[model samples]
Target: MKKLSFLFIIFILIHSSVSAIDRRTEQFSTEFGYLTLPLPYVIPGAGMGLGFLGGFNNVPFGST
Candidate 1:
């Protein structure tokens, strides 16, 4: 019984700790002009990127 309880506690701790890390990619791209507004209460965290544009034609050279 003690061993089972210890294993359960360990499992819970591991799961919780693993989920604290953000597993999202660091970069993204959009083909069309758009805007992104994150939630007011949730500040954007590290390991993230953002971009804006008005239209595809206005994009600088060498960008596709």
Candidate 2:
């Protein structure tokens, strides 16, 4: 019970200290450019081609 009370006091003190800090900023910049392309359709096609090549190489009867 004593340990629990000590932990509760520590928690309250830490919580109060954290609440006292101020975090407000008013200066910022937003100038950026990026390029993105779809991959879900591209990756599966590439993976299938790679897997077919691997299977062909492993099995002598297989061909691509």
- Tell me, by lDDT, which candidate is best: 1
**Candidate 2, residue 19: how far the Cα is off, in Å:** 1.2
- Candidate 1, poorest ten consecutive residues by summed lDDT: 51-60
Stretches > 4 Å off in candidate 2:
20-64
Stretches > 4 Å off in candidate 1 = 20-64
Per-residue lDDT of model 1, residues 2-64, tens digit only: 999999999999999888667586445434454555433434675455544332433445755
RMSD of each candidate? 16.3, 19.5
Quote each prediction's TM-score.
0.33, 0.31
Clashing pairs in model 1? Answer: none
